[model samples]
Target: MPVQKMDVFDVIVSGAGPAGATTALFLARAGKKVLLLDKEKFPRDKICADNKTWKCLDIVKELGLWKQFQKLPKAEIYGVLVASPNGSEMYTPLHEKDIAERGHWYNVKRIHFDNLLAQAAKKEKNITFKEKCAVVKPIYAVHSKTHISGVTYHDAKGKTHDAWARVVVGADGSQSPIAKAVGHSPVVKGRYATNTRAYFENVKGPMDRCELYYLKGICPGYFWIFPVDKKTCNVGIGMRPEDFERQKKSLEQILRETIALPQFKGRFKKAKQVTAFKEWGLSVLGKRRPCAGNGWVLVGDAGTFAMTFSGEGVGPSMRTGKIAAQGIVRALNENDVSARNLKKHYEDALWKILNPEVKGFRWLEFLLLNERLFDFVIAKSAKNKELIEISSRMQHDYTLSKKLVHPKTALKMLLS
Candidate 1:
């Protein structure tokens, strides 16, 4: 922990989020020296629905850690209910009566769940976990335009430390320092995304299931009420950055009005706000080249790999981190840590896991914004099982439209 001593690690991971921690866990399992660094301590709170999807469960199971997660306390689910502005409802059941089938998913507190996962990496003997460390700059091997060799960071004591590694992985959040250091910085615009959220405890009025409300003008940006516990839930709204700007009200003010709706009037009357409402920009990935360069690779939000539709990143970040680690392991084994070698594996792994979903979400996003089209789909899907199922897949991938039977119904409606 001394700043005077320069530490050399085989792989240095920045930002101990899902991606970074998973990368460290995999690297340690591979018998490599891994150093995991984070600006904040473990078990931190994040703004999200905190629900792990079926796809996420499958990935966790493949990692051999699914059983452990199953043992944790889980939220009960009857089904998900989608309510449209026109009073139409689409319900999807979460439980499967079939013996061979699994249920949809479970919701948990990120404070507890993320800590548990991060602890898994800490349990590995080869991984060095450091908290309260902010990465200041990436150490480049050649000139500033070349490969990154390591990082210069400041620890909790405000003492600076230089870490040298063959490869560095940036698993930081949307606002990634490593990404900026590597020159793949997020381009923030008022056009792409606007964030607003409020968490509630003791929420009432028939919220046993996840509820999504698609307000008419809000289009692509809907409101979500996700159950966190029997008595606690996260209720918030997200909209296009442009729409949010036009409202001329703070996100908090808008959220207060949203909760005052007829449906939520009595339910959240006594609800407690766990945290103050705030807004942050969502970074929609631009058409950038690969996220990895010589001796450096980016994972999770640092790489702009978040699927914009659902605004969920934890599961994807974990998968991305694991893939980045795998590539590092392969390159290290071959004694070739070139950016090209590591990038090929990282990019392939990311696209395989997320590209389809990203495309699908983008399409849904487009439709959600088309007021007339979105209203038609919502109204039509209210009672149509086929329409409901297809629209649901939009959250997974917008490309589902291309594969849906009778896709013309929605396409023609939207186009018209």
Candidate 2:
């Protein structure tokens, strides 16, 4: 097969999801030539819970895309409803001030959400957006095998091509080829989560909030009901891969059983599934891994920046992309694309912003492992105004979440 040589760019971002698109958009806006490639075409569906919090909205607002985002088909999420294994439920509104200021958070289908970002990237004059482009591997420097120089991919016509870039970003999801080619691995074992989601029509429930059910059978994980629109809902379940495999039950089976539980019986009685159950892997954020190296950087799931407790990746992923772009811009300006330089500016800065939350969420996940402990926390939050306020604020601000995981607070929750 003849390999075609394409124009060299300042940055080549693999996987044009939220991370890739955000990175490309920022780089392009800064006047850098960017090549954004993805395996799937636009308007494609991606496996996700479709939930977006204030953090995500902040990014969208920064990009000047909030008005456009509001125009997409979505459901407003006023708060979160968490149900414990023992049938105890608690509703934590997403910060009273935030609700009053922003109305509500949102749940938009990934297909639409991703397409919106990709489309925005397309409008940037410096960005070259290409769909149906599948990146195969990182192209290493001939003299140094460890240094990535560019990438080789197959275009829509099945033609192989070599595209060079000063920096290659692995914004791809969990199973990223660039991550493996760059010798990056998950820092923590059993940190990945397996999730399955499907769309349902006429899901009988209040469409104003997202629901999370923490059952005994799936400790450390939860089943979610996220409304996507007036008549449709994104229903899904997530679990640690080991726990999922140990149960010896398929996601579909677990989901079926979960819906039939006494608490959710009537909610699905009038609901009809409109889509097949689709499974995906979430590389939940835990231990920090190498994200930037010679001529390459990883963002999104490829960098394992997804939230540990909520499996929320969109906000973190996009935030990392923005941060990575800032670092890349500085590296390009300095004419230094070496691993040492990129790692110092990119990885270090990214970790500075992400490490605290990742560590805090990891501890929270640990506490939720015990059914009785988890139930106690949820039940208490229902009656404790202080605890409920802290929980609600934690969803929007990581600083507040740290307080919840503080030794003092943890001890109080444990004893109470």
Candidate 3:
């Protein structure tokens, strides 16, 4: 179908999740004419574990939303409890200070969390938000199929329109249309993980921290129970695609079996399932392809920046959005929207900041995938207070985490 060109924008961000919303928010705050588009309306449900790390909290604070985030109903996460295949558990506090002093992490439903960000972006004078707008394809420049000039999208009423932009930001997530249109493989099959999540109410023994269980059935992946409130928890499981296919059982079946395990059976005996199972894909950071190209850049899941080990993308996604916005601003100022320019200034710099952590997590995922190694680490951490502390700190501090994947530490861990 022919697309009708509409008003031009300084930047058009596709998708309104954390990445897109953050990108639009930053750009609009800088007085850029930004258009934010999303297929769904605000407060729509998003499939995720719904836990925010310290890094994610920092971005929220950076956006000046920390006070408002705190005002919302959320569960304060203090630490993590990890259970090994052998049922041995290790408890690690997230930080030294209490939630009051340090302002601990949180577990919030994405429906509410995303809406908060969308609302923030909506308030920006330079940001024009269009919900129920689905981006169908990238509009390329005349005589150049490789360079994106804008996007063609369909509104709720099925009206097709084209909006031109100097640079288009692809925050559309794992199944990003922009990434597809640009001929970039958004997710490498081997590096991708499949995840399924559901909400449960009246869950017993709900703790103030998140819990992860590495069972025999799922080695490379783990099951998580993240409490969103006193009565509700986000329960989910994640596994490599190969592992998932090998199991032959559906994710729902795996979830059921996981909850029925000896470790979790009692806690879930009285729990009531509040939502149906929903699934999504995650592309770990290390496996991501080039995020920047002519007249466009991809952020968040669209750029495949989720962590390898934990499949956490919120923090990394938001960070990428901020970086992309900065890069877009620079590119706009210089009037250089070429792929080479954006790639050199934005994509390269993004990987520089994120590569080390991605490599570290990739190593961690490799080690944790081994059942014996995972069991040993969990068992050892259970008895070793220092190791537990280190493990806890690694969740928030990438520099500290690098030590875990070091040759010396790996040898020590294996030998000991």
lDDT of each: 0.73, 0.86, 0.85
- State the lDDT of candidate 1 residue by residue for 1-416, as single tens digits: 76676799999999887778888888898999998999989878776667676545656776677778877766755567766666566776543441125455677777777777788878889999998998888888765567788999999999999899999888877777778876665754522567677678888766556787877656566788888777778778877867767888877777788789887788888889887775666665434447777888888778876556566667667777778888889988988888778877777666765666655555666655565655666666666666656655543345775433247765654454
Model 3 spans > 4 angstroms off: 1-5, 97-102, 405-416
Question: For each candidate, how many residue pairs have backbone atoms clashing (under 3 Å)?
Answer: 5, 1, 0
> What are the TM-scores, per candidate, against the unseen true structure?
0.89, 0.95, 0.94
Model 2 lDDT per residue over 292-328, tens place: 9889999998988888778888988899899999999
Q: What would the per-residue lDDT of candidate 3 be over residues 1-416, giving only the tens digit for each residue?
A: 99864779999999999999999998888779999999999989999898888667878988999878887777988888888877888888876753445577889888888999999999999999999999999999999978898999999999999999999999999899998887767568678788899999977874698988877778678899999987899999998878888889998899999899877899999899999999887767665477899999999989888877778888889999998998889889889989998998789889888767876776676667677777777787677666777787776665566665567766766666
Query: For this target, which candidate reaches the highest lDDT against the unseen true structure?
Result: 2
The segments of candidate 1 whose C-alpha lies over 4 angstroms from its true place after superposition are 1-5, 71-73, 85-87, 94-102, 142-144, 188-191, 206-208, 285-289, 391-398, 403-407, 411-416
Which window of ten consecutive residues has the lowest lDDT sum in model 2?
A: 396-405
Residue 234 Cα positional deviation in candidate 2, in Å, after optimal superposition: 0.4
* Candidates ranked by TM-score: 2, 3, 1
